[model samples]
Target chain A: MKMVLAILISAILVDNFVLSKFLGICPFLGVSKKLDSAVGMSVAVTFVMLMASAATWPIYYYILVPDYTYLNTIVFILVIAALVQLVETVLKRFIPSLHKSLGVYLPLITTNCAVLGLAILNIDETYTFFQSVVNALGAGVGFLLAMVLFSGVRMRMESATETPKAYQGIPITLVAASIVAMGFMGFAGVADGIFG
Target chain B: MEKKGRLSLLFNGVIKENPVLVLLLGTCPTLAVSTMAVNGLGMGAAATFVLICSNVVIAMLKNVIPDKVRIPCYIVIIAGFVTMVQLIVKAYAPEVDQALGLFLPLIVVNCIILGRAEMFASKNSVLNSALDGLGMGLGFTLALLIMGSVREILGSGTWFGIPITAGRIDPMSIFLLAPGGFFVYGTIIAALNKLTKGRAIKRKSMGCDGCPSAAACGGAGTGQCPPDKEGQS
Candidate 1:
């Protein structure tokens, strides 16, 4: 239990997938303009990350660990692509309301490096099945935290009229992201301090 | 599509439509592996190889693939090449493979490969697609190299692992961190915006014009996410 908590806290705070690890940055910058969309996208990503880990962990250990590790990348991506499609279809059919909120983001998740990166990281770290799932949950939550926080920063940036022209559009958002990421860097030792 | 000469198509991605600096595709690896100059170059080469090979194969099969499922087809093709590259890197340059870590395999999802497959390879000749891939691959490499060099120099006081600033100035380790990645990338884009006088197609936060998957995702009825939403570069 303590080990799980350590992994969860470290993943969420110290090694945040977006803020620290630089994964899934596209959506981090794009969908984070609106708080509502940020929340929705994060929920969708968190769910997908969990499902992808659940599916890939077993496939990798049970089927590919001995001889086919090389195939993991291709297999994982194809599985994730198919999984996203299936999730979208099932959601739209049975849970229309949920689908309406997450449907747009589902297709986008297919190419999200965060999902694939997390899958690969889980394998690289050699975590147990439950640990992998916990790590995924932590990563998803961390991403959510980053998005929600950055959206607030972006919302504030929207009203600031003094921004220079060269720093407009994506450039300024990146700078804001830089500051937000700096804040995350301070959490680096806190995880170890608490759990070590 | 304008009937342009082959050389121009090859050179297009080098500067004008530079995938990273301009189109903003594949930003993930651009920032991740670019912590060091050598890693950036290695990553660039690997991605270039995959890009060229995938482009050639996809262009060859463009006609046979149904429009409805071409996106999946492109992904599968890209993923195959990424695995091949992953294995090769692990075998020959285990160090880079180590440095890149998960990013090496994560290359399968790099938007540059898939975007080119959908936007250029699907419509052009095999030769043109290959050239575009080479050009774009080079462009992506060049961008990564620049960022990596900048970060390495400022962050670690070295370039390609060789000592460049041993004593004159202290290296600010922050440049190698996540914040530094964003700051450097932003500054470069700002510099380019200044140089181009804002002519670059800077995709507004809400617009989907430059996104590679816009057609596949948005056109397929899940379009509510705004094409720009997937800009996960």
Candidate 2:
């Protein structure tokens, strides 16, 4: 129980996927312009992360690790790609409303490094299946947290008039994200204290 | 479309369409491994190898692949190359393998390789695609080198793991962290923008236009089309 909490806290706050790990930054900077879209993207990514983690864990432990560790990268990616397609099809057919909200971002999640990052990270950390699910959930939530905060910042940035030409777009957002990441650094010790 | 010369094709990725600084394709690896100069160089080299190999293969098989499944096919090809690179790196350069960690495998998803496959390699000859890969790979390496050096010097007072200013002066340790990576990346991009008079890479809009996957990622509402070219079309 304590270990789960530590993983959750560490994944969501201390070692955030976007701010700290730098995964899924394309969407972090791309779709984070509006609050609505940011929320939508976050939810979509979280769903996919959860599903990808659930799917990859069994494959890694059952099939890949025993004799085919070398095939990990190739196998995991194909699994993710296929899983995204499956999710997209199911969402379009059953949850049309949610699919509409997600739009192109759903397919984009297949390429989002955060999802793959979570899968690879689970193996790297040698987490069990249950722990992998928790970590993925935490990462998804952390990604959502970062996206919402960044969307808020971007909203204000869009309205600001004093921004210079060079710092107008990505450069400014990156700097802001840096500050946010620095703030999250304060949580680095929280997990250790609880789980150490 | 006018044909690009060999030299220009090679030089383009180094500066004009650099995967890291200009195209902003692979920021994940760019930020994660840049804490140390050697790590950055190794990551860049590994990605470049995968990029060049995948680009050539994709270009050669462009016509053979159907449009509907091209993205998946491209991914499979890219993943194959990444796996080869990962195994080789782990075997020979275990230190770099450790430093890069999960990122080595994550290279399969790096948009730069796929982006080049879709945009350049899919339409060009094998030789041209190879050159494009080489150029983009070197460009990525160069950008990583610059970022790594800045962070290493400021964060650890070291250059390539050798302490340069251990007792001479206090290093700003924050530069070694994630925030520092963002700050340095942003500063360098902004500085480059200033130097190029904002023409080096167009930043007039902040949408999917900068994304390598923008072409195939329709419905993000940013559209796959470049803004400036939209008016003419």
Candidate 3:
């Protein structure tokens, strides 16, 4: 039980996906422009990551490793692509509001490094099926936390300087990411106390 | 179809369309591996190998793949090349392979490789496609090396892991960490924009209407915008 909480905190805070491990940075820098859009992208990514880990865990342990681990990457991508497509449809049909908001971003999830990164991380650590699921959820939450916070910062900075000639667009956002990454490092010690 | 020329392909990748700086693709490895000069070099070589292999194969098999499953086909080709890279690296340079960690496999999904395969390789001839991949891969490696060298010199007070400032000066440790990577990446990109986009920026200053499809100037001239499927897209 203690290890469980440790896993959650460490994954979400101390060894963050974006800052420490550097997994999923493509989305971290790509989608983290506007606060609202960042929030939306985070939610969608979190959802896909959780589901991706869920699906890929079984695929890795039961199907791929047992028979043909060589087929791992191809199969994993196929599963993720199919899952993203299915989620896109379900969103379009079931969650109309979310579909409207995340219309195009849904398909982009198919190519998101974060989701694929999470899938690989789960296997790299050799977590059991259930543990992979939990870790996946934790990673998704961490992605959301970082994405939302970074998004909020970028949103503020967007209107902060009237867009300087030098630090105009992507450069400014990168500076914002630097600050966020530094701030997130503060959580490195949190897992120690709770887990211990 | 116009017989694809080699110079056009080479020119497309070098100055006009760099994978990292201009297109903003594959920034993850750009930031992470750019921490050390050796790692940067190794990564560049590895990516170049995979890119060249996958681009050639994809260019050859382009006509055979269906439109709907093109993405998956690209993934399969890329994943095969990545696996081959993994094996070759482990066999020849296990240390570098281990250091790269999951990033070696992650190359399978790199936007630059897949982006080129989808946009240029799939549509162009094999020879020109190979040239395009080689040029772009070299350009990317060059960028990574420069970024890594800058960060290593500042962050660790060394170059390529060799101690340079020991007992001499304080290391600007910020360049070694994640925030450091971000600032370095940002500064490097800002430099590129200023150097290359002077005309674009000037036109914008003179108010030349909307953003001049900033991509063409920064993309392989495949008669299209940035393949939409580029970047994290």
Candidate 4:
């Protein structure tokens, strides 16, 4: 239980996916233009991360690492693709509303580096099954947190009247991210406590 | 089918339509791993090799892949190439592989690869697709190198591994970090946007009417296209 909490907190705060580790910056920037899409993208990342961990953890331990380790990349990717498909079906069947909300994003999650990164990271870090799941959940939540925060900030940046001639649009967004990243720097202590 | 005109395809990835600056795909790598010029060049070369190879293979097998599973098929092909590169780099340039880290395998998910596959390779002939991949790969490398140079100098006081900042400057480490990546990419993109505008002005002076995709624009849904984009280059 303590380890579970450690992984969760470590992923969410200490080594935050977006702000600190820089896993999923594409969606954090692109889908974050709108608040709704930002939230939607977060949910999608969460789903993919959770399912990817659940699936890839076993594949790593039983199949890939022990037997065909050379095929880690290929196998992990194939597993992630299958898991995305499974999640799509489950969402479409169980949560139609969620399916609608995360329509295209459901599949797009397959391409989200965060998902594949987490899947491979599971093996790299060699987390226990439960730990990997908790870590994935926390990482997903962290990604959502960072994306929403960025979107909210960008919403403000867009509405502002003007700025320096140079620091407009993307330049400014990046500056804002720099500040956000600095803020996340404070959470580095979280990892110290967890790994300690 | 025959590939589009060679010059058009080649030039497209460089200026008129750079995958990173213009199309805005692969934002993760553009902003994450471009901290050092060497890392950027290594990653770019690796990505370029994979991009060209994957484009050719995918384009040739375009007809074989069913439309429904096209995304999966393209991903598998891409993942295969990425794995091959990963192994090679791991064996030889382990340092570069470490610098890239997860971003290497993350190539499977790099939108630039699949985006090009779905948009250009899936439709065009093998020759054009290979050329497109080569051009896009070079443009991507150029963007990375530019960003890498900016970050390395400002953030670390070094240029391409030669320590030029010995007691000469105090680097802003933030610019070398991930956030720094975004700021650099944004500024470079804004600059590129301005250059595109300059070209547009020249074309308008020459009386070419306007761009082909002017009606389409960048933010098609939001109706806020980036100032001027005459993809006529």
Candidate 5:
């Protein structure tokens, strides 16, 4: 139990997928302009991260580990692509409301590096099944936290009139992201302090 | 086809339509591995290898792949090449393999590779696609190298791990961290914007249009994404 809590807290606050590690930046910059879209994208990404980890962990250990570890990249990507398509169809048919909120971002999530990064990181860290899931959950929640925080920063930038023309659009947004990331850096040792 | 000449296609990627700066594709790796100049160069070379191979292969098999399933086909082909490169790097250059870590495999999802395949390779001749890939790969490499050089110098006070500051000035280690990566990338884009005087395409122009999945997505033909939420912002 303590180990799970340590992994979860460390993943979220310490090695945040977005602010600290720099994964899923495409969605981070693209879908984070509005608060609603940010929430939608984050939820979709978090769901995909968990699902992909759940699916890939078993395959890596049971099937790919002993004989074919080199096939990890090819196999994992195909699985993720197929999984996203499957999830999208099922969501649309059975739970249209959930699909409506999350559907647009679902297809895009297939190409999201964060999903693949997390899957591979699990193997690299040699984490057990439960710990991997906990880490994924932490990563997902961390991503959501970063998206929500950055979206607020972007909202302020949208209304500000004093911004120079050269710093408009993506540049200013990135600069604001830098500050948010700096704030996250403040939590660097907090995880260990509390959990250790 | 627009009848673009070979040299023009090559030049198009190098300057006019740089994948990183102009197109805004593959921002993840652009920020991740760019902390050190040598690491950035290694990553650029690896991605270039995968990009060129996948582009040529896709261009060759463009007709064989069914139109509806082309995106999946492109991904599989790209993944195969990424795995090959991953193996080769691990064998030949263990240091780069270590430096890149998970990002080497995550290149399978890089928007630049898929974006090029769907936008250029699938429609053009094999030779043209290869050239396009080479050009785009170089452009990506160039951008990464520039960012790597700037960040390493400012953040770590080193160039390619060589001590340039001579220990006279204290290095700002923050430049080697996550925030430094964002700051340098933002400043570079801002500088590019000023230099181009808005001639280059900016993020505002890069919604679903340049996105490779835009074709099969529900947001197809819509310039905006999160289709219904455009007005809420």
Candidate 6:
């Protein structure tokens, strides 16, 4: 249980998806201008990440590992693409409100590296099925945390008046992100300390 | 179709439409593998290889693929090239393979490759598509090279693993980390914007429209201008 807690904390704080691991950056930079869209993108990405990991873990262990490791890249990508389509359809049919908010982001998730990166990281770390799920959830939460925080910062930046012309747009946003990332770096050893 | 000049097509990618710095596609690999000069070179080369191969193939098969499922078809082709490149790199260049690690496979979903396939390759001829791939690939490599050099020199006091500043000054160390990557990426882009006087690439509102996948996504393609704008309305 403590290990699980450590994983959750580490994923959310220490090794965040957007801040540290550099996964899902397309949506991170693209959708982070407004808080509402950022939250919507986060929820959509988290859902896809959780579901992708849930599906890919078993596929990796039971089918792809022993004999066909070579096919992992092709197989994993196709599975993710198909999975996103499936999730989009189901959401559109059952939960129209949620779909209305998230539908725009679903197709984009198929190409988001965070989902694929999580699956591969699970295999590389050699985590079991349960741990994989925990890690996915943690990663989702981490993505959410970073997106919300960055969106808030972006909102503030929009109202500022002292910014120079050259450093106005993405450059300023990136500088802010760098500071946030440096702050997150302070959480580096907390996982070991807690689990040890 | 009006034929574009071959030279312009090739030159456009290096500066005008650089996949990394200009289009802002494939930031994941750009920030991840650029810790060292050599890793950036290797990653760029591998992605370039896949890009060129897949673009040519896609251009040839454009008529054959069904319109509705064309995205998946493009992905399959891209994945095939990526897997081949991964295998060859593992066997021939073990060092780069280890350095790139998960990112090597992650290239299968790189926005640049898919973006080119959907936007350029599917519509253009095979030869023109190949040239586009080459130009874009070189531009990507150039950006990675610049970022990697700056980070390595400032962050580690070295260039490509050789110590160049052992006694010169204390390395900032942050430049080698994630924060450093963001700073460098942003600064370089900003400088480029200023140098070109904003003619190089326009800084538009971010979201699905700015995204390379915007051409194919349901949100932006269906007349919605990203949800951020949606909230304003």
Question: Each candidate's DockQ score against the native complex?
Answer: 0.68, 0.53, 0.44, 0.30, 0.58, 0.57
Residue-wise lDDT of candidate 3 within A141-173, one digit each (tens)?
898899888867867876786755665777777
Per-residue accuracy of model 2 over A80-150 as CA lDDT, tens digit each:
87887787778788998876766456677778888888998998899999999999999999999999998
Deviation in angstroms for B118 in model 3? Answer: 1.7
TM-score of each: 0.96, 0.94, 0.88, 0.87, 0.95, 0.95
Over 4 Å off in model 2, which ranges? B1-4, B218-233
Query: Whose DockQ is higher: candidate 4's or candidate 6's?
Result: 6
What clash pairs does model 2 have? none
lDDT of residue A110 for candidate 1: 86
* B6-41 per-residue lDDT for model 1 (tens digits): 788878998889888988878888888888999999
What share of the reference contacts survives in each candidate?
Answer: 0.75, 0.64, 0.46, 0.47, 0.66, 0.63
Task: Evaluate candidate 4 and give its CAPRI docking class based on DockQ.
Answer: acceptable
Give the better candidate number (3 or 4) by DockQ: 3
The C-alpha lDDT values of all candidates are 0.88, 0.84, 0.75, 0.74, 0.85, 0.85
User: Per-residue lDDT for B41-113 in model 4, tens only?
Assistant: 9989989999999999999998998876676777789889998999999999999988998888888877677
Chain B vs. true chain B: TM-score per candidate? 0.93, 0.90, 0.82, 0.81, 0.90, 0.91
Please give, for residues A53-138, the per-residue lDDT of candidate 4 as tens digits: 88888777877656678677777777877877777778778988877777546555556678888888877887889888998999
True-structure lDDT of candidate 2 = 0.84
Report the lDDT of model 6 for residue A21: 88
Model 3's C-alpha root-mean-square deviation from the true structure amounts to 5.1
- With a 3 Å backbone cut-off (N, CA, C), the pairs that clash in candidate 3 are none
User: RMSD of candidate 6 to the true fold?
Assistant: 2.5
Candidate No. with top DockQ: 1
Judged by DockQ relative to the true structure, which candidate is superior, 5 or 6? 5
Better of 4 and 5 by lDDT: 5
Worst 10 residues of 6 chain A by lDDT: A163-172
Instruction: Give lDDT for model 6.
Output: 0.85
Model 4, residue A27: C-alpha shift (Å): 1.5
